[model samples]
Target: MRILESDGSIVDIFAIYWFGDETYFYGMPKNYGGLQAYKADEVTVIDNKIDFKTVFFSNDDAKSVHHWALIEESLLDDLLELDETAYKRFLDILKSEGQLDDNFY
Candidate 1:
């Protein structure tokens, strides 16, 4: 048996597998057309509300369209804790493909 975050929440971040930047990530409601990307030290973690006005940039530079959704911290912890085994396995796949780092919280 397997557990999941959502239909697109976890499915969207497979950057390396999709021939995209390993450092990039996707937000909720995962629409591939408006995917997110990052390079270098651009990825960040915040403990506040998702500022709808906030913008993220990638190697592409500037944005024509943006797609993101915020997942609450407590909810995030619950997901990780309850689904530890399956989550780790998914992370391992990313690690093997060089898309994720050990910094998962």
Candidate 2:
């Protein structure tokens, strides 16, 4: 997801997940394992206003999170170090994960 910042810059958010009372927001650059995990409470406010409980994705959504983590640990650093082949494989994995059809060649 893309968020428009207050400074008129566009930021890309890869994923967001919740665990217990915590909400994790992933939006860091690819080379840094951009996973930010935080807790949200009744007093927690965004845009300077309190909000109600936030619904989270189902348990199955964990698979996607796990996959991304694996990709980061296994490929992110290598790809950033100029490994073109690893980059290609990373793209393939992403395509496989996001593909809705069988044409993921």
Candidate 3:
């Protein structure tokens, strides 16, 4: 499992096999073009409340459309806590692979 933190919200990304069920992770990141078979599950809200749990990370060497080992899951933790330096490094990798663009938020 992989977690992305955007502001105070969290986005959960999982490979299909480990995802177990389809209730939360309904789709993949738009940039993936629906081919990578990974799911991005965003937090859901009811009224002014949000429902979610902090997910952790583990070491894995899964390859995607982009280059490998540039951004490693092992470097990230369960709280999805990436320091500014680490975040920038990860972002750079995404940008280099064209996974992030002007329209992404």
Query: What's the number of clashes in each of the models?
Result: 0, 0, 1
Query: Highest TM-score: which candidate?
Result: 3
Output the number of the lDDT-best candidate.
2
lDDT of 3 by residue, 8-83 (tens): 4333242222333432331224333321232334444222221222233233532222123222443233213425
Q: Please give the ranking of all candidate structures by TM-score, highest first, separated by commas.
A: 3, 2, 1
Summarize candidate 2's per-residue lDDT along 10-104 as a digit string, tens digits: 33334455665565544323343233332223222233221212233366435224335334447545544656666457546555655212342
Report lDDT (CA) for all predictions.
0.32, 0.41, 0.35
How much is 7 displaced in model 1, in angstroms? Answer: 22
Point out the higher-scoring one by lDDT: 1 or 2: 2
Candidates 2 and 3, the one with greater TM-score: 3
Cα lDDT for residue 51, candidate 1: 24
- Candidate 1 residue 28 C-alpha distance from true site, Å: 9.0
Reference-based TM-score, model 3: 0.34
* Stretches of model 2 off by over 4 angstroms after superposition: 3-73, 99-105
